[model samples]
Target chain A: MPAAEGTAPLAVILDQAGLDGLLTAIRAKGWRTIGPRVADDAVIYDEIETVADLPMGVGDEQKGGYYRLKARGDQALFGYTSGAQGWKRVLYPPRQKLFSAKRTASGFTIDPMAQPDAPLALIGVRACEMAAINVQAKVFGDKDFADPGYQGRLKGALIVAVECTRAGDTCFCDSMGTGPEVGTGYDIKLVEMVGKAGVTYVATAATDKGAKLLKAAKGKPAAEADLAAAAKAVKAAAKQSRKMETATSAKLKDVPEHARWDQVAARCMTCGNCTMVCPTCFCTTVEDVTDLKGDHAERWRKWDSCFTVDFSYIHGGAIRTEVRSRYRQWITHKLSTWHDQFGQAGCVGCGRCITWCPVGIDITEEVAAIHDSTKGRK
Target chain B: MAERKRPKLAVWKFSSCDGCQLSLLDCEDELLALTEEVRISYFLEATRKIEKGPYDVSLVEGSITTPHDVKAIREVRRQSKALITIGACATAGGIQALRNFKSVKEFIRCVYAHPEYIDTLTTSTAISDHVSVDFELRGCPISKHQLLEVLNAYLNGRKPNVPRHSECIECKANGIVCRMVAAGTPCLGPVTQAGCGSLCTGKDRGCFGCFGPMETPNTAALAAHLKELGCSGRDVQRLFRSYNANAEAFRKESETHG
Candidate 1:
């Protein structure tokens, strides 16, 4: 493949040592490195010391609503689907302190809390995960009311995205247009290549920050053949994905009030696991914790979900008291109404909601039902 | 001496999970600023601060289930200038309204350790069912952005720009490919109201109707499609009788299947 014109070509083919060198270079820069690691029955994102900590030679078995880890025949370093965790855990965080207050002789003196750390490097991020991050950035950073905490944490984080060589059955990034290939908004992108000699990686710098990092690593410049191999890998991943094709935006707006929502609601436990695991879900609730001394009070912000009943309370009563209404609110907001607010789809097509949903309610099937019925409306 | 007037804002709770009230406090940065704009009169969730009403604006959460609640709501109505119901529990009777189908006593016995202690009414009803609601914000937990929009609108004396369209409109505007058409997946985006912005559909999942019915929802047609996709009649009935079971349209649809 020919390089795009006018863009400086910064590419390298790294052997196995290149992986360790990359992690070493990131750590040497005083930036914390977080990636996928094995933990209790599933792969979770955590801090890493070296390349050895990464999930090597492992692929995930994912279905319509199920996900599991399995062994890969080849000892490949980047051969897995997305895990239950996303970068949101580190960037947004599950819980954080907002402010602390104390009563003084004159009045109350409230001290605001500082945001989380900066300059964290996220390695092995997928295309879908990157899309999720962008969606969250809009929610927490771009709007009229920006979340200071999220803004502080995301300021200088470096993203090292990896292109998927294969997709799981549950994968639908292709349908969402988020990915099998790394798109814009990454610092560095990596594509792993397997051959008779050994496992190697073709790395490319997406930004000036990425180019600066690549200058430290010693590797051969990528040949035209290498870039072609990377493109082929991305295409294969896309092909492997199970396609879902409804005019998602149009159907969501057109379908009339339907009983189909009741079908999924009947099995939905409303446990809120889906929202908890979602990468872009930023809704939260606050709690006040008063110190035993009674002079100081602290407030905390924690993640909240629309699936919970208390989320919709009113003076006379709850607006959505039934399971169907709650389910309807969540689905519509994600697929249809999110556009009006954000000018983009709220979902990034990661399929985390499907695999993590305890009852395995599939979103693709629900949209198809609506499309078939609402075609006339369109 | 001249007196400073604070906008009296009352936070009232009925039958809910107490999540929407949490959204107000969830405005950690804005919460302090908000207090300066309005008086924290009757929020039981945040503080023990209780102030007498004739409130400027009242934010009520949860549903009315018992006979006592019916009378309490009337007093709330009388005391507030503008009333807004937040979340699914307040706007649609919430998931607890599942009891709208079966005997309330049986539901109580199924979950409670001491059913006798459960002094509840047979049906869990929404705020609008009993009294006039100025505005209704939809969501199991109303979107904080939408909540702020409602507050800002009322404070400015203007109509809130809440959408009355379906979820399908949001999905199209976002440019997300229809998951159901491409993958044979069933979705509720067509009939459901827009608020969630097609979050589930973008994630490759179907709409579950957490926002409630759209303005002119055609649930029967969507139900027929679900039947074609292998759902049973019981499935159709159960679908409508969910979070908004007590809602007029949803309740009527479920009755048709039943």
Candidate 2:
């Protein structure tokens, strides 16, 4: 439950020591707390048991087709940009068994598999990732035939968002109007500031649950100076971000006809890496598995990508036969057609597609190329 | 009238490392259950019991390298209702296709003491190149999961839902960091098919394109990107000429660099 929309939001200040209590509060409510941890030279989201598991004093450098972990002198957890993994994996798993069937004397008896339905409390979620999750909600939470698996995990979930204090080389969430600041869609919004005094966190409660947790944690009301510092950190992040112009997204419909796709196709492996790393990508293919006895069979739904040739397969042949066409479909759908289907852009400007692409093809640059070529062609 | 009979299945091998056939035995948990549904009529690797076919499904492993193998494969196709080729060796000539570039006589002389005793074709080719194939599973060693899916699909009389995408998709779905981006390593995952479960990437190495090129792969684009990553023209050529070198997409890409 959240306070009335017009009411003033409650704010509190917590030092490094108070972070432990915040984790305790979330855990005390019987919620699985997930946060960032250092693994594979990048920040990965996983179950966090204690503060020590967090990637403290760690910063990451991310560019188009580049990522490296850098150690910062000051201990600052949640200091890096979003990594390869996101909250989507927790909600919509990579692979899930839909149901299993056993051969009966007559035909077959099908048994639906039970989905993992534990309540989750996500900590240190970036604003861009929040937008991705929100976008995915529309894809999976459709009224006609919503995905029960995603819905089950989403129910009673808590989001503890963290505003960005720094931006990566590929980041453009500011231009996407999705990040660098946390305005909504969160239970508690935390802004961490590392200063000469010490590392401090400014937290604002947007919901009753968040407010109760903030009150229970050992913390004082945030001073005006502390609030100013938090705002400055976020402002700096926004200023540093290498942004993609959102206006280009409007003209993305003409991208398929552009010659740039062929040029991109030459350098593109059609690897589907970008689609896989994209938090909002929700395409999937079903697989049927049977035991040698043929008595037992199971249907599994695994995460799928549009970059595959089979992804567009029709009765006769593939619809999108060229690698260039597949790339065009992917980028266009993310930027323009998604608006037609979901009423919101598919991309959140988190730049995962740029960072994780095997060849370092930047989506922002592709959009710019399309915009430049399609100019006045209408 | 004959009693309700189980479908007879046969496994055949040609010129390969026997790794793909091992993938069948690797399904240890399902082996017993599988035998109950389909009779293992002619798998020489597993059992001595050989039942002559009119096999319901025939699983072929390895490429057609020798002149004798060419005749053997046609007869096998005649006996099989559905013929499926498994692994790079069967689907795209395997690493042996490297001979397609060089002289077979020179290779035989270099490797064997008696070149006169050796009998091999100048080129190693896919089974489909010689005979009609119902399905082809791609991989250096076809995934066990995929093999099972293919069998299940054929048994149900439906198309197998095998993904024809690059390894980049699997790496991302599994939450793996791109080795090329993070380490400046050149990877062929962009053009290689998805089936190997991102094996090399999981081990912190770039994909070596063991599964060959995905459908309509943009090899020229990937080659140019590889060049930018400091991979020389020869390096790019060698990369494409590995396991599935004779594959149409990879063969064309490698030839461009060569």
Query: Would you estimate the TM-scores of all the predictions?
Result: 0.60, 0.94
A1-378 per-residue lDDT for model 1 (tens digits): 113569766898888788788778878987899888765445677888887888777777766545667888776877888876678888877667888998787878998665546468998899999888888888887779997767766767888888998887777888878887776668888998877788999999877767768767777899999999888877888864455553654346544368787777666645455676678877776756553233566777766667655567577766876767777787788877778889777777787777765446666667777666666673
lDDT of 2 by residue, B80-168 (tens): 99999999999999999999999888888899998888888999999999999999999989999889878877665566778777777
Which pairs of residues collide in model 2? A266-B221, A267-B221, A269-B190, A292-B33, A292-B34, A293-B33
TM-score of 1: 0.60
Give the Å error, residue B205, model 1.
28
Model 1 chain B scores worst on lDDT over the 10 consecutive residues at: B173-182
The DockQ leader among the candidates is: 2
